[model samples]
Target: MNTTIIEHLACLEINNLILQPPFHLISNIQWNDKGLSFDGDIELYSSDIRKTDFIGRVPVQIKGTTTHKKQHKKSKIKHSVNKKDLEVYYKDGNGVLYFVVTINPNTHDRQAYYRSLAPLDLKGLLDKLEANGNDSITIPFKKLDNGHLERVCKTFIQVVEKQPKQYIEASNKMEFTDYTFNYADIQEDLFDPFEEPVYIYGVLENIEIPIETATLFEIRKKDNEVITIDHEEINVEYELKETKEVVSLIIENSLTCEFNKKKKTGKINLSSIRTLGSYLKCLKLIKYQLEHNKLPFKPFEVGAKINNKKDFKNVYDDIKMYEELIEICNKIGLRDNYVFNEGENLSSLFNGIIDIFKHKKYQLLNIGDNRKLENTMLYNLKLSDFITIKVMFVDNEFIDFFGEEILSKIGGLVPKKPINKTTAEWDPNNWEEIYFKASIYSNESIKELQKATNFSFENLKLSYTDQYHDIGIDMTINIALDFVNYFDESLDSRFMELALDLIQRYLRKFPDNDLGKINLYIIRFKQFNKLSEEEQEDILEILERAENENHKNICFACEVLLQNKLKARKLFSSLDIISQTTIKDFPIYRLYQNLG
Candidate 1:
C-alpha cells in the first residue's frame, strides 16, 4: 500500500467508459497564505479534450488516506484506470479508450487522481449530473460549521436501541421480583432495515453514564426451587464521534447504490456504504436548497437566517410548493446576476428549469487583454468534485461509458441504466412522405439527420448552437452512409434502400476519413428475402469462389435485382426477388454436401 492519499482517491475515480462525459477536475488546492494554488496538482485534469478551462496550472495537496482497499500479491497486482489517466490520455470524446493500469497497492507508483475544482460554475456541473440520472443535489466538499450542520440535519430522525434487560423490583417493594421483556429482543426484532439510518452511532443518546457495566440474567424455575440458567457481565464503551439534537421526522425517501464489495475470500453486498451516505448528504443539501429558495451556491446566507426550528418550518413549508426553486437560483447565478432575496414567491420566477443546477457557462475571451471572469475564476478551483457529485445523478449514457472502460479497469463492474426513459421507433417514416429517414442519401435533411445519426442531439445543442441544424443534418447523412447499407428488411425496405443510396452518394461526394459502417441493415435485408433464379445463381457462384473481400457487394447485387423488377412494374413491391430463388452454395447447403 505504498500510495498517496490522493492516489487512493484517484483509484476511486471512474476510468473505462463507453460514453464518458468531458470532465474538468480542479485538483484539490494546497491552501497557504495565498488564496488558491494551481501548478501540475493531482486534482486538476480534464477527461474531455474540448473542455479547456483549467489547463496548465492547478493547485495540488497531499491528502490524508481514507478506508480504501489495496491488494498485496504480485499475482493480484492487476492494472486499473483512474479518472486522471482517462482525461490525460484521450484526445477524442467518442471511441473505445483503454489505459493500461492496475489498482494493486504496489501499482500506485503509476496512478493519479482528481484535484482542482471550479467553484461558481457548480450549476453547470449539477445539470450534467442530473442529465445522467442523478436525483441528488451537490455541495462543495468544504467544511460545514456546527450551526450549518445543525440547520441541515434539523429534520432527521434518531432511533435508539438499548441493551438487553435485567429485571428489578419496584422502588417501594424491594423484596418482590417483577419480570419485564428483554431489550435485545425488541431492539433487533422491531426495527425495520428499509428505513435510512441518519447516523449509526454506538453511543446512547439518553443514557446518563457514558461508561457503564450492564448484566443479563436468565432465570429458570425447577419445581419449587428457583435457579439462574445463564448470566453474563458486559462492559460498554461509547465514544460519541458526532451528536445533534433530536429533530424527530419521518423517512422521506431512500436510494440504493447497488454495488458488490469484495470480502476476505469472496464477494459480498456492502450495506449502507457508498450511495446511502452520499444520498443522505444529497438530501441534506436538497433540504437546505428547499428552505432558502436558493441553489447550493451561497448556502451561508440561508444558514444565517434560518437558525431556529420556527424558521426551518417556514422554509420547509415553502419548499413543498416551490420544489424546483433551487434550479431557478442556479439559472440566475449562472446566466444572469443573482442577488439574495428574502421575500415570498421565490419559486415562481423560473419555470423552464430542468437542469439549471448544472454549472455550464458561455465565456467570452478578450484577445488583447487576457482577464478571467470572476465567476469562472471562482469555479475553476472546485470543478472536479462538482463533476463527481453531479455524475452520480446524471443520465446513463456517460455512466455506461465509464463503467465499462474505467470501473471495470480494476475488475470492478457497476451496472447503470439511463436515467431518462428512451423510446425507439422501428419506422422512420409515415403516411404520405418519408420526411424522417435513415438511409444512404447524397444529402440528408435536418429532420433525417437528427432521426438517424448516432451523434448526441443534446451535445450538438450545447456546443454547436448556431450551425447545429445545418451541420447536424449534413453530418447525419454522412455518418449514416458510412454504414454499408442504410436499411435492412427489419426496417422499411424502401426507406432503407433510398436512404442508403442517397447517403452513399453524399459520402462519395463528401467523404472524410473514417470508413462507413458495415451496414447491418443491408446485410439483414439480404438474408431473409428470396432472390430471382438468375440472381440466386450469381450469389452461389460468388460463394463458391471465396474471392469477394466485402459481403456488401453481394447484398447490393440482391437489392438491385429487387429494385429493377419493381421499377419495370411501375410500383413499389414489398417482396424481393431473392425470396423466389434458393442458393445451392449457401453455408447450410455446403454443410449438407460435406455430410453427404
Candidate 2:
C-alpha cells in the first residue's frame, strides 16, 4: 500500500478511540486542505444531560506514522513541525493536544503517543530552536499508555467548574457596601498603669445602623499556650432619625469586634485595622509587664524591658512587632502621616528614658538639688573637659532637652574671641594688649573669621596710623614667626602653610615696605622648602616683574630660599651695591657674596 493510504487508515482508528463514550469529537472540515493544522476539537461532557455548564474542550492535532525507533531499551517516536505552523497554533490562544499513532506492518498492532501544548510550551520550544540555531524542531514522545489523557480531562473539568463559584463570590463582594468609619473621630482615653482590662472608645459619627455595642480584646499567647486575656467593653447607644438611626460606640481599644449574647468576640489575629495609637498603648502595657517581672495572668514567662539594650533580643523583637503594626496601619487606609507622627513622639519618649539610664552610669550630671556643679556651667570649662561634657550629654540623651543654646555657648568658648574682629585698635605703646590681640590670630581663628565675615584673608582690611602702621606690622609678623616656630616644634605642616599665607597677603598689600619682609624672610624660607616645583616656577614669574630694588632684593632672596645654585649665582652677579640693612638681615647674604 502507498504511504498516504496507510497514514489515513491509522488516523481513522485514532478518531474512533476518541469518539468513545462521554467524549465528543468535532472534525475539522478543512483538515485535508489545511496542511499540518489541528485535526479536530474534543469535548467531554457531564454524565447528566440536564446540567448546562461548560465541561471542557481540547483542540487536537493527530499524526500517523508507521516508523518506530528503539533507544535505551525503550520504543519512542519523533515528529518534526515547522516554526511558522507552531507559532500560528499557539497564537490562537486555545491550547492544542497532539497524538501520534504507530502501527506494526505485519500484525497491524496500533500504539498511540499523546502530548499537550500550552502557549508557554510552544514558546519554550521556539526558544530551544533559536538556542540551537534552527528554524524547525523535532519533538519526541513516549507511548501514552499510563492513562495520562484521562487525567488531563479530569483537571480541565475541575478548573472550568471553579470559574462560576469564583464569579459569584466576586459579584457578591462588588455588591456589598462598607459603612463609613471616620478615623478622625476616634477618641482614646488614657488607662492607669495599675488598671486591668483597659477601657477605650472609638466615637463614631453619622451612624445609620442600630449598633448595640463595640468591643476590643487583647490576646496574649506563648508557644501556642494561652496567657493573660484582657478586653474592653464599650456601650453603644442609638437614636432614630427621619430616614436612619444614629449610633454612638465606645470600645476599649481601636480593634473592631462583634458582640452577641453580652459576650464580646473578635479574631485573635493581629490585623491591619489595629491603629498606631493602639499599638503604642500595647507597648506601654508590655513595659509595665517588664517592670513587674511577671505577666498579669499566671503560668507566663518573665518580661524584660523593651528599652533595655542588655536585653537586646527582646527589645529587637518588640521593635519588629511595632514595625509590623505600623505597616498594617499604613495598609488599611490609615494615613502614613499620622503613623509617622506617632512614631516620632514614641522615639523621643524612648530616647529620653534611655538617656536617664546612661547619665546614671556616667555620674556626669548631678541631678540632685544639693549638687556640687551646675549643668549650665559645663560650657565654660576647658576645651578637652568641655568636649568630654558634650559627649556625655549627647550619649546620655540630654542634648535635645537642654536645647541648642548650650551648644552655641560651648562653641563660643572653644575660641578665644569672636571671628568678626578684624583689627586690634589698641594704643601702639600698649604692648600687652597688642600681644593679646595677636595671640588670637591663628589658622582656626582666621578660617572662622573668613566664614563669619564672608571675606578672604587677603581682603581683610587693617587700618593703622603712620606710626602705628610699623608697630602693627611688626606685631603681625612676630605672630607669624611664633606660629612658624610652633609648626617646627609640633611638625604641623598646616601651621607653616597658614603662617606663610598670612605673611604673603601682608607683603602683597604693602610691597614697598621692606620691614615686614625682612622680619619674615627666615620663616618664609622655612615655608618655601615645602612648595612644589610648579609653585617655585609661579614665584619666579612673579619676581620677573620686579620694579624697585626692594622687590629685586626679594626676588634674589627667593632664589636663595629655593636653593637654586644657577639662579642665585646669576642674581648675585647682576646686583649693584646693596643696602646695609639687607646685607645684615638676609640669611643667605654670605652665600650671595661668595657667588659674586
Candidate 3:
C-alpha cells in the first residue's frame, strides 16, 4: 500500500475511535521521509508552508506526476513532511507523543512507510471519521496462506511496536508477544483482567480480598480553629497490639469547649476478634452432653461471654462440672493468670459476653443466618453465682429458646436480589451478553462453541485492534501514554472528545489544500516542547482541544457555586478572606494560604 494511503488510513481509524463514544483506538505508526524540499522552498510565506517546518510533522508531496513506474528512474527529490502528517501536539511543556505510521511495502525493503502523528486530537478525529462512516475498512487476515500470514504477522508486530508506553504499562503484566494464535494453545495465551488471587498464607494465586472495608479510614476536620484546639482529631490513628494474639484498637476523640473544668477521657473497646473465650464455651457444652450421656446436638459457639462474678459464686464450682474445659482452655493458649473483671457496669459485662459469643457462633453457621439467634441466645445462655443460683433458679428455668429452622432461614436472606431470568431473556440487548447458544448439543459442538465464544481475551484483541487494525489506536496511545496519562475511563472519554472536537474545528477552517491547522498544532506542541512539525496536523488540533476541555471540566467539578449572597458571604467570612474586594472577586482571583 502507498505510504500516503497508510497515513490517511491511520487518520481514519483515529477519527472512528473518537467519534464512536465508547470505543477507543490504539495505534502505533511512524511516517517515512520528509517531503521533497527545493532551495526555492526557503523564505516561503509563513502561511505558504516551509520545508524544514514540515520535516517530521506531516507528509506533504511536492505537486508533480510520475510516468512509467515499472521502468523506474531514480531522481533526487528532497522529501519533507507536510501539515497533514503532524497529527497531535501538547502545549504545556510535556514531552510530545508522535504517532509515526509505517507501512512496509516489501519485506526486502527495511525502510518502513512512516508518518509521525501528533499526540492525538481524539474528539476532533472521531467526529470527522464517524461523519465519514469510515470505520469498516477491510484488513486482509486469513491464516491459509503462509505468505499472507507472514505479512499480517509483520504488520501486527509493527502495530505493537507503535503502541505508546502507557498502554503497555496498564496492560496486565503477563506478556503476549510469544502467545500462539492457534485454538489449541488458547488457555496459555488467554489473559483475564478480572481473575482475583487466592491468599494461602498471604500468597495470592487466583483470588483477591476486597479492600472495601479494610483497616483504612477517612477523617475530616471542621476548621482551622477547631483543628488547632483538637489537633489529635485531625489525624486518625489505628494501633494493633501483639502482646498475645493480635488485637486491633480504634480510638476517636473530638474537642469540645465545655463549661466544666475537668478533662474526661472515655475509653471504648471497639471490638475483640480471635479471642480465647470462644474455646471455653465449646468445652463446657461438650462436657454437659457427656455427663448426661447424650450426643451433643451441636458444636458450642464461642462469641457468648461468661461472667465469673454474676455466673458463679466460686469459679471452681463451675470448673468442677466441666473439668475437661480446663484442658481445652489451656490447649488454646489461655493462661492461668487470664481474668476478665466485670465491674459495676452491668451492661458492659453483658455486652462483652454477647460480642464474644456471637463472633464464634456465627463462624460455625458460615453460610446461614445467625441473626435470628441473637435474641434467643441472649435469653437461653445464662450463668448465676452458686450462692445466688438457688434463688435465681427458683424464679427461672434455662433452655435454648430459638429453633434451628428459624435461625437457618434468617441467615439465608440475601441482601442483593437476583435478576429475573425471564425479564433478562426478553430484553434484546441482553443477547449481546450471551457467549454462544447453538442448539446442537454434541460434545464437539459444545467445545467449539465454548472455545470460539470466550471473551476472556477480548481486551487483548481490543488493544491489538486499536493499535494495529485501526489508525486511531496511534492517536489514542499518544494521549494515554505520552502526555497527560489518561489511565481511567473518565479521562479517556474527555480527552478523546476534546481532541475530536479540536480536529473538526481545524479542518473546517482549512481551504481544501491549505493545511495551516496542522502547522499551528505542531507549533503549539513545539511551544510546549512535544511534537515535531512532521506529524499529522489533524491529530495535533484534537489533542490540544481535549487537553483544554479536561482542565475546564476538572475546575467545574471541584468548584462550589455561590447559590445566594448569604451563603457566599458566610463562606467567605469563615474562609477568613483578608479583603472584601478579594471576596467580591473570589472567582476571578486566586488566593494563597500559609499553614505556618
| Model 2 worst lDDT run, 10 consecutive residues | 238-247
Off by over 4 Å in 1: 1-477, 481-596
The TM-score, computed over Cα atoms with residue i paired to residue i, of candidate 1 is 0.18
How many clashes does each candidate structure show, in the order listed? 81, 2, 89
Error of 3 at 570 (Å): 64
Residue 42 lDDT in model 1? 27
Poorly placed runs, candidate 2 (over 4 Å): 22-36, 48-53, 68-76, 146-148, 154-596
Q: Is candidate 2 or candidate 3 better by lDDT?
A: 2
Q: Across residues 1-596, which tens digit of lDDT does each residue of candidate 2 receive?
A: 45666667557655666555544333342334355577766665555333464466777777766644432134445777677767776566554667777765555667776555544345556667778978788876545543345445554344333223223223333422433221111113311122111212222353222111112223222222223323532121211111111111112243222222223221211223234454444443344444564333333333333334253236347746655544432322222223222223445433432343333432433345435433533221111211111221332233321222223332211113343562655454754443333221232333333222112222122211121133234455655655565565567666566666557766777765554554355565565535566656655555565434446566666676566668766766666755435553333464344342
lDDT of 1 by residue, 388-503 (tens): 11111122111111121212221211112232432333342431122222222223233343332122223222222221122223454434432223332134454444445544
Ranked by TM-score, the better of candidates 2 and 3 is 2
Residue 363 in model 1: lDDT: 25
- What are the Cα lDDT values of the candidates? 0.27, 0.44, 0.26
Best by TM-score: 2
